[model samples]
Target: MKLKMHISKIKCINDLTIELPIERGLYAITGQNGSGKSTIVASASRVFFNLPMKEYFGDTVDGAMIEFELDGNKRSWHKKGKSWLQKQTGSMNIRGFYEGSLIYGYRFKDTTYEKLKKSESIDKAKLRPSHEFIRKNLGLILQGDEDYYEKLYEVPREYAKFDSSIFFYEKNGIQVSQFHMSTGENLLLSILNSLYIKNKERKNASKQCIIFLDEIELALHPSSLKRLVAFLEDMARQYDYAIYFSTHSIELISGIKPDNIFYIERYNDGTIGVNNPCYPAYATKFLYDHSGYDNVLLVEDDLAKSIVTRILRKEKLLNSRLVHVLPCGGFRNIIKLADDVTRNNLLGKRASICIIVDKDVKEQAIKYKKENGLASSCGMNFLPIESLEKYLRMSLVYNVDQKLFKRLSDYVFQQRSLQELIAEYRKLKEFDTDKNGKVLYSLLDTELRNRRTDRAELIDLIVEYLFEENKQPIQDIKKFLHKELE
Candidate 1:
């Protein structure tokens, strides 16, 4: 089952809709602070568990409503003068879904430890085994405790024993409970324990489970946050769980797939918008990140960056003091970063942003601009050729001087002519046709490495020769660089 939520007139978010697969995977909700991340989670919690709306959104719930879709069926809860009217329910396994928990503000403390110590609820003999997942992963979050073992401690109530008394022990039997544990340790243990207890109660392990964790990365080190994310990803896959976490951590976003990320933005019009499958760079709060460069050029990949760098170096603009060329991984990502930086003036008065993509994507860029109303003045432009790889290959096969060709023959072809190597390379059944020519680039790198030659230097040399042959586009880009620099 998948879930789609449409929220209207809720707190800072005037209107927003987010759809995500709920069967099994990790999903991230990311944005700048105060972009109504908590409100989205609260709304889902209210819909799924019947939690109160006033708990998240206070007295100003005048015309607020949330419409939800499970699979293709729709149901809505509309606010009517402090009361809510529920519509027809969807064909959902409410009991199966409700078995999962919504954990918000996951900050654990020693208060539980104090209660355990004061009360006579400790059940020493009725010990359950510590979760292997938690035991193996806890060390990754806590420093200098890689060899530590987790001890499951239970506190007995009148009817049953609660899994609240968690403890840890070192190799020498040095034990530490939640009272003595660090905040990160306490948080990790509490979360794992809660999940373990809940999941154990499930009658069917294959049933879809949904877990919502809001502000999931609070009060943890970046390294610990990364480890926790890895754990969640594994659990989500292994248990057929859909884990949705609302976070502002770039660390969290770095590990998540772009398609799984949803970026929430508060527009100037006082309404909220969602950018699903958002590029990680676009979701990053670069407005306040303070990149030291005065000007930045966003490109599709490292090859694009290399091409831009070669041109800038030739124009005397390659100095890191004046410009920084960064590869944003893909065409869409570079486009998103360009849009985000331009609209927000993210670098402010101290810096400027330019986007340069390969000419192969010129058509896509044109289509994107026509569809999205992206201004031409946003500084988006294309490289002179389809791509640097194709250009370099053309130069290598046809345009290089005999002296350079002889060097290539000696190093890349084992002293054979380029023709012979080309014939052999083309005969391979699975010739890579990747637009960026990644496989060709790797082959070139390996060949140069075998001959004890620097691949980058050879590429730079090829780019230099190509510049002499292609001056018009080079000059045009130089002018673009000059304008951005100023």
Candidate 2:
């Protein structure tokens, strides 16, 4: 059985729709954060599977309408709420409408009984339905339900007459104990469980099953992610099961078969839309350019791309044909993009990635890079949001000492510039009650005796200080650079 979903009339959306191909491959949902990608999935689940929207999403201004295709027939479902569910003052309504002669009288209310009857016939007569039958044969693994906490040590088998589990990696630590027996053992165990279930169902059944994984990159190491994707693809072929997932990771999409990939975008009005890049017109153009690129450069956001591009051009590294600087939009995209590129041979062995994220993401970014064997690139760089001033100073080759750095950081936090900061310091110095302002002035005066370096190097030092601290070997040099250059 295959399921295709289309959404409309949801909150913040005027007319957003998506079509999920029910083929034996993976489908990824991707977009920027707060773009309503998750809303689309949640809406679909609520309508088609009769799942509660409140459990996953709060009440919003509007309800959703979903259209689905099962077997060769089409059906539609509608959902509406009086107020956002979180307000705890509204009621939600979900109703189904069926189309086509085969299911003319069928409706959502009758589906349970209909499924029971169908299953009874199959079980009693020991007869097999056609492999393409719609309702009774599919399986699902939601984002956070992969591992059964109660079992603790057992993996669940697919099509085992048990409810499907949705696993959310960000909320639940990766269970690695059953696999690597290490820190992320819980995570590894979850992955193994998913694979084990898929294999078990394949061995027992003649019909194909569909698996939907939302945010598939969560809690997965790069190597583990790579392996999981490959295994899913192989399972699609060997077991005839179809896989669909959503991610913001650009790396996860790179180099995959165009026929298997789908792109999603949401509008400000809250509507969602889908794009199939493999369609003849779209595929042809991207295919040509896809071969022309080698390495991918990921940025934190679109603005970062613009800023970094200017800096790279200034540094004369922007002209290289071997490197391509593309805006991935966020850290998740960076990780996904890296995973996809490394797994695909189409990108080639020489392909490398550079990720430039903010200092706030330094911890997660460094962990991802190190786990993925990407720490050696010098390509993964973190720049503090507050260090833009440091960049401005370095652009003039002005040495920024530790005292200056601290002062600048404080100034930036206060939304002031260096000159403004100096002026304010002077004004406070006149009062001189505690002499804190004068002390700051004296510190800055003494620290400004060193030679200045490039802005990029200065930004790197600030990031290292905030994130890597004593763990990084350059801490001493970074301090020396700041003290001597200022």
Candidate 3:
């Protein structure tokens, strides 16, 4: 499935379009509160998000246009002066995909649950939101229709561990509804129902459909949100649906692949634009404008985050109340982090964001920067070696044998197994720094394992070596701290 959209003068956005082809996968629209992220989704889904066409008009503007190509067929809606026109028609039924009114045709800003709770009359207030939502989602499947719902068998492995889950039905002698479903669960059921309904939209046509879920993270517990994201991603891959979702949750952005994400923001010129998450300015803006942290160092993961935190502590610069290391999942997030930084710099929001990306992705990082012409405002830096592991490995104190260095190098650098290297280290009675970094993240886990060694203690050993031998990296970090803290 492919969708190319162009909208101009239809809100804060003025002449917005994306040149690259959008393929079937998840597309995230993210930015500050008023960045027109919702407007983009609203325009894509007109049936659910219908607003007065003229109300979206720009100052001194007489016309507004929103056009898009769905499955290579061009369809457009234009408002010229006092008139509106549909330039072309297509077989794709966005309206039909709304399925049935029983599914709750459009999403409501306020939920029925809230309304019922506030009502004074008890007789009219005792309805469950999950009743209609679950029945529509799972009801048809249990009856006979299985083709669509069957895809859910590939549910993420994480769901098996859900101590609490939403149950639609209980057969034989089982009591249910005693276990309450979360708002997140109800919302997930509603979305799945929508997809099942979409399948019914182009029945047996083998047609592609677009599903736009706005601010999908609502009412979601973090764990529930993660499960939902994984489910939706897997669902998109397994089916022909092209998913378009919007979220301000950094967790959601990090959960999905970098290529699948998009960023939207209000520009300096009183217009809003949509851009790739890799845009350097996007991350800058995100950290300064949208997020809660005051001073953040964006790193690759927990291990690197730990190292940075330790280094900051060594320097006595880690103000627990003000500064922290945020591992943005991976190297690709550098761009997203950069985007946040750039926007913050522009808005004068007074945020300090330092990004430390892995060395492996430096080439891809530079290429993206040049391609998008992202201003160098993110204070971006690349690791000297492959990963945080490599740095720690090299920084480890080599004892017992310089003779074992060759043997260690062979096992460590060969991309061999971590368990193999650990075994070699134990047998040789030598301590080699870990460059592969597998141990870095495990060291940061708060819960202690009974059998597991105190890896945090060993980290101090490596860090001591780093402080004594590797002075340059610390100096660089100090610079970042000074800038952010000041």
Number of the top lDDT candidate: 1
Encode model 3's per-residue lDDT on 1-486: one tens digit a residue. 346778877666777875322345766777777777766776666432344544333332556777877666677778766776667665544332221112232432233554433332222123223333335434342323323232222111133222222233333543233124444544555566556555555456455566777776666666656666666676676665667666777667766554466766566788665555343223323443335556667777545666678767877775654675765655655565566466646324654566777777878877887787664566677653456445544433233323334443443323443335445554542233434544533332222233244445444444554566568876776676666666
Candidate achieving higher lDDT, 1 or 2? 1
**Order of all candidates by lDDT, from best down to worst?**
1, 3, 2
Cα lDDT of model 2 overall?
0.45
Candidate 3 off by > 4 Å: 19-22, 46-61, 70-72, 89-190, 200-203, 279-486
User: What is the total number of backbone clashes in candidate 1?
Assistant: 0
Winner on TM-score (1 vs 2): 1
lDDT of 1 at 113: 47
Candidate 1 lDDT over 108-170, as tens digits, reads 222354565644344445444566766756775554354455454433333232324445444
Residue 481 lDDT, candidate 2, scale 0-100: 25
lDDT to native, each model: 0.65, 0.45, 0.53
